[model samples]
Target: MVIHQNFLPLASSGLPVGKIYLGYLFIRPVHNPETPFKMDVSFIKHWKKRTTLEVGHRGMGNSYTKCAVARENSIHSLNKASERGADYVEFDVQLTKDKIPVIFHDFHVMVSVAKRSPEKDVHQIAVKDLKLDQLRLLHLDHVQHHSNTPLNEQVIKVTGENDEAEDLRPFPTLIEALQNVSTDVGFNVEIKFPMVQEDGINECENYFEHNEFLDRILKDVFLHGGKRRIVFSSFDPDICTMVATKQNKYPVLFLCCGANTRHQVYQDERTRTSLTAVNFAAGCGILGVNFHSEDVLRDHSPITKAKQLGLISFVWGDELNDKTNVEFMKKTVGVDGVIYDRIGETELRSSVFMLEKAKKNELFSKKIPSPVQTPRAGSVHFLNDQPKIPGLNLSQSVNQPHHEWPISSSSRRRSPTVTTEAEKYFAASHGLIQLNQGYLPQQLTTAREV
Candidate 1:
């Protein structure tokens, strides 16, 4: 079991406080004990003070409803989002018939077939039924209500002509995306699981087993994720549960329709409302909740409630397309992240993560001053004239005698190892220690002053 201690600032409420108060501690039990890997989740959780992260939905934007530069979930779209300054890009991932995870939004694709008639006939087929090779060969089009009618439209092209480049083509594998997309950009992978809609209809029938499906995708991510920031989200509560328990490497977010009038709600009770979603996420030790825009706009109390529970909140939906709504969510509601379409359409901005990284580099790159001479013999002085590193306790080092400083046994055999105050500050700030074992006490006791 992993116990996460979340410290929140309490100065705003006018209460007597130290630097920070222990807001809450949540326990996440390991369901798959055999899985040995664990990940640091501080990057996603510790973003309240920074600017709200902007994520490009389905990479630049969903191509079905709105006109997009490239096909949704294509490599072209993902790179476009990275170039446009999105902190993270959200895309849908589902397995093909051969269990190859591919990036696609819908469960079915429209394929054009030529027959005796002069016009080509269109047929709708589930993406899971087709192999990877067959799916790539077929000229795909958007699924239509009238399948009998002959329409020669291609899904990738905005205009009437089929002039899309290879990168703009759909059905790119999950591995392909991990390899080709910008390493600086993060990825919000939405697991495509079949769910029961509000109207007693299944989104897709006879899908792969939940465990097998999730395992396949997780394997691909673990093998190729490297240092990229990644988060897994799903509307299905079961999928979210499995994702959280199966591996501790990535954070899982419960996607909620959240009492919205815009779209049909799923039959699952957890996804029916944002409040219930928060309750479920908190109870399950899940990282956060991604609320639909319609519900939060109507009553933003859910976001406040999420923050109170120490759960990160992100807003998504078609309503986020409007720049005004995006600002309201970011400034007024104070969401951790926002997923929208047509990123950089109004204005281009650098990622908040990248900006913070640059600042850290600039701050650390400045040369440190040499140790100053002390009045007394066998004494050393530091930081008297140098800029102080944040979170570093310099007083302890300055007051202690040079010979009395704690040194590791290995240092005694060789030259004395110097653990700089800046190194300690950076280690603690970046969560270099193991998270599942608890960090605060361990970092304090183990990090000795040199």
Candidate 2:
């Protein structure tokens, strides 16, 4: 997007109004005494169209974020992500004082000060200084459901079955998240703290009494395991080691960051540059690595080398600063995923994928001369084409998506029905993800039913 600005005065107010030239469109400012505002945006030349990775940032990216949606860790947000075409979602979970594993991100809750001490105003008091119960009464300013509104307002107004759906949102337990997630999408679960003391933060008394919290999370994860892929991550080496050793089924990812970040990783860990932080994770015999994208670019190096070592790489950052960065990571660096702030963005990119998928399905129908079944993007159909149905028009129109698609795929959709001289023909589910469930219109068929 390239933007050019021009200013004009309002006849009513004599204030300078602005008009922005963005490509062919003229954009005007929104209610700010400005005539028109222009923002010229363009992506990096090196980074073009790339596959948009599925991601979940906390729950709903709304007001109360401390994993407090009664169903915050509920299946709703996860299902919402699914609707948005997310391939996977990220969440933070940790242990509570009761040794129960809970899904929460921040270390403290923001509470208003207790009623004035009968003297001076107590408004200056910090929320963290208050006890858990005191904080409980006070609502979070940032609710996952509504952005930065008062939690009390959201709670009073929210209409759901449980408190999780209510406003003062208590954190979701680990069992709660495990039960809620989609079996198909992958999970990027960041363990809130470590099992043992690194220096002082993860001491047994502070974080958990025993490793029972870890055990409980892993147990629930394994017991109800479905098609969902699991990736466990933590800044604590002890926790990383435990996940690697104790859980044999899922993949373990080591999370590393700088001082201001949630957890710290030693500088010695940057051995694999081309492959990025994924190399360090592989070195530890874990599955992958999640690094700050700021570290990815600011380091001024490539991580492709690390990829050769079989390390899965991912970046978390404001990659959306420009869509070009998204292309750079996927096309040039070949990262496994990029987590970001907006879930709606993922949908725009997915539409491109669906369009390409449609084209590929058409190409597939050409090579196989069988039932001539064509499944719609995001849908599946059992077709029995007839003279009444008429053959599909090959050149009706090109299905173009609003967004750009990622790298070209190596595989193509296979024909669902196969008929041969020697073998009998049958049907199978098309391999497209999120296959729709419905029937072709009655006007579409006179052929035999399956």
Global lDDT of each candidate: 0.75, 0.47
- Each model's TM-score? 0.71, 0.52
Tens digits of per-residue lDDT, candidate 1, 1-450, equal 332432222222232222222532122343333345444432333433567899999999988767877778899999999999999999999999999999988898777778998977767789999999888876666764324644555443321235767688788999999999999899999999988777887788878766678888988997888888899999877678767766776788999998888776776667788899999888778889999998998999988888999998889998899999999999999998999998987896987777888999999999999886544431122211233455545335543323232323542221123366643553354334434322221223544532
Q: How good is model 1 by TM-score? A: 0.71
Top lDDT prediction, candidate number: 1
Prediction RMSDs, each to the true structure: 18.1, 25.5
Candidate 2 RMSD to the correct structure: 25.5
What's the lDDT for candidate 1?
0.75
